[model samples]
Each structure stands twice: as C-alpha cells, then as structure tokens.
Target: EAGVAQSPRYKIIEKRQSVAFWCNPISGHATLYWYQQILGQGPKLLIQFQNNGVVDDSQLPKDRFSAERLKGVDSTLKIQPAKLEDSAVYLCASSRGQGNINEQFFGPGTRLTVL
Candidate 1:
C-alpha cells in the first residue's frame, strides 16, 4: 500500500502572501488529518476529515487558514496572508478509521518559510 503523499515539499513566501498545500491519503483510508509542526515542537493538529466532511478544526485559524477534502479523497490547505509565525512543516496523515486503535500513516510533509 502507498503512504500519504504531499506536494511542494518545500515552500517559501513573503509575509502576507498566500500559499497552498495538497495532500493525497492512502487509497482505502477514510480518516485524514493536517498538522503543523514548529522547529522544536511536536505536530499540532490543525484539522481532521472523515470522508468528505470535517470532523475537527477548532485549532485552525479561520482568519488565515482554510482546508477542504472534496470528494473525500484528496485535500488542500491554504493560508492567505501568511504570517512569519505560520512557518512550519505541514503534515498529512491518514488512518483506516477514527479512534486510537487505528495506525496513521504520514507523508513527508511540506516545509514552509515565511519571509
């Protein structure tokens, strides 16, 4: 089976600019997640999607960040007017189902830098 896949493994943008990242989860996975990881911190869950519907997004910054999992297969995350503090590695992960019983497979991640 293939693992998660993410595009633009690296991105650099000026502050207040816009950037977008894409993710393709495992073929049979039904649960997908997006996470942000700072240089020295663990990954923080930004959003979660079960099929085509959002499951969680309380941590996502609505003012500048948005994501979608259309068709319940591939997903995209966009950050408009990016901030310096937003620079981090964006991770895409997927699992067979919800809950801790399932193991999540992760993509390499896209590293973002805001200048």
Candidate 2:
C-alpha cells in the first residue's frame, strides 16, 4: 500500500499572506487527520475526517485555518492571513479504520515559516 504523501516539504510566507498544503493518504484508509506541531511541542490534532465527514476540528484555529477532505481521500489545509506564530509543521496522517487505530502513517509534512 502507498504511504501518506505531502508536499513542498517547506514553505516561507509573510505574516498576512495565505498559503495551502496538500495531502494524499494511503489508499483504502478510512480515517484521516491533520495536525499542527509547534517547535518543541507534540502535534495537536487540527482536523479529522472519517471518509467525507468531519470527525473533529476542535483544535483548529477557525479564524485562520481551514481544511477539507473530499472523496474521503486527498485533503488540503489552508491558512489565510497567516500569523508569525503559524511557523510550524503541518502534518498529515491516516489510519485504516476509526478510533482505537493502533497506528497511523505520517507524511514528511510541510514546514511553514512565517516571516
């Protein structure tokens, strides 16, 4: 099976500009997630999708961050008016099933640097 894939691997943006990152999860995985990892901190869940339905977005910064999982497969995360503090890695992962999945495949991530 294919592993999760994410791109640009790195990004540099201004504090008020907009940027987006893309993800392609492993085929046949039933659950997908987007997470934000700040320097020296664990990754925090940003959004989750079970197929085409959102399972969680509780930690996402609604004012600037948004995401979508269309067709329950590929997904995208976007930040508008990006903040200086948004300079962190945006990680994408996926598992074969729902809750209690023992493991998830992770992508290399898009590391954003807000200038």
Candidate 3:
C-alpha cells in the first residue's frame, strides 16, 4: 500500500562536489527507473532495471553518473564532480511489469542545486 520513497528531498552543493540519492520502490513492482528532469523539460530516462538486472542505461553519463538496484528493491543514484548543468530533479519510478499497459508510479523527486 505504500508508495516509493526517496531520501534528502533537497540538496545543494558546489559545482565540483558529489551528490548521492536513494530510492525504494513500491512493493511488488518488478521494474524500476531513474529519470532526470530539468526545469521546463520532461523527464529523461537515465536507467532502468528489471528486478536486479539492468535493462537499460544508455542515457546515463558513465563518467559522472551511476545507479544500481540492489536485490530488486532499493536503488541509489550518484553524481560525482557534479556540474551546474546537473542541477535538476532526480525521479524514481516503478511499474509492475515491462508491458506498455503498466502504469508507473513515481516518487517525490530529489532536487539538486549546483552552485
């Protein structure tokens, strides 16, 4: 009955600093996703996981951004040496299945500010 949960709803750091965000998906959900949403732009998928296996991560910036889903439950996203451009909302979502008909439930995002 519970929804997805995220930690540190807001974060502020210098441009070169690193930041990390955490997410716990809804119960019984089999698919999880991490998205980045800049102001005035729609969310962009950064990575997706089906259970504990990574399904997609092509859009993730390997040099600075990384994410992982542990045991098909909790997830974490981190950005190292954060850039000004990385200031945005990091969203976590989960769905029951990978099919098109499945509706994804999103958690309250983590807002990151890079000074």
Ranked candidates, highest TM-score first: 1, 3, 2
Q: lDDT of all predictions, in order shown?
A: 0.98, 0.92, 0.95
Looking at model 1, residue 82 earns an lDDT score of: 100
Clashing pairs in model 3, backbone N/Cα/C closer than 3 A: none
103: Cα error in model 1, Å: 0.7
- Candidate 3 lDDT over residue span 1-115, tens digit each: 9999998899999998989999999999999999999999999999999999999999999999998887889999999989999999999999997988999999999999999
Candidate 1 matches the true fold with a TM-score of 0.99
- Candidates in order, TM-scores: namely 0.99, 0.96, 0.97
Q: Candidate order by lDDT, highest to lowest?
A: 1, 3, 2
lDDT of 1 by residue, 24-88 (tens): 99998999999999999999999999999999999999999999999999999999989999999
Off by over 4 Å in 1: none
1-115, model 2: which lDDT tens digit per residue?
Answer: 7789998799999999999999999998889999999999999999999998899998899999989987888999999989999999999999988868448889999999999
Stretches off by above 4 angstroms in model 2 are none
| Local lDDT at 109 for model 1 | 100
Could you give the C-alpha RMSD of every candidate to the true structure, in order shown? Answer: 0.5, 0.9, 0.7
* Cα-based lDDT at residue 1, candidate 3: 93
Predicted model with the maximum TM-score: 1
10 residues in a row with least lDDT, candidate 2: 96-105
The number of clashing residue pairs in each candidate reads 0, 0, 0
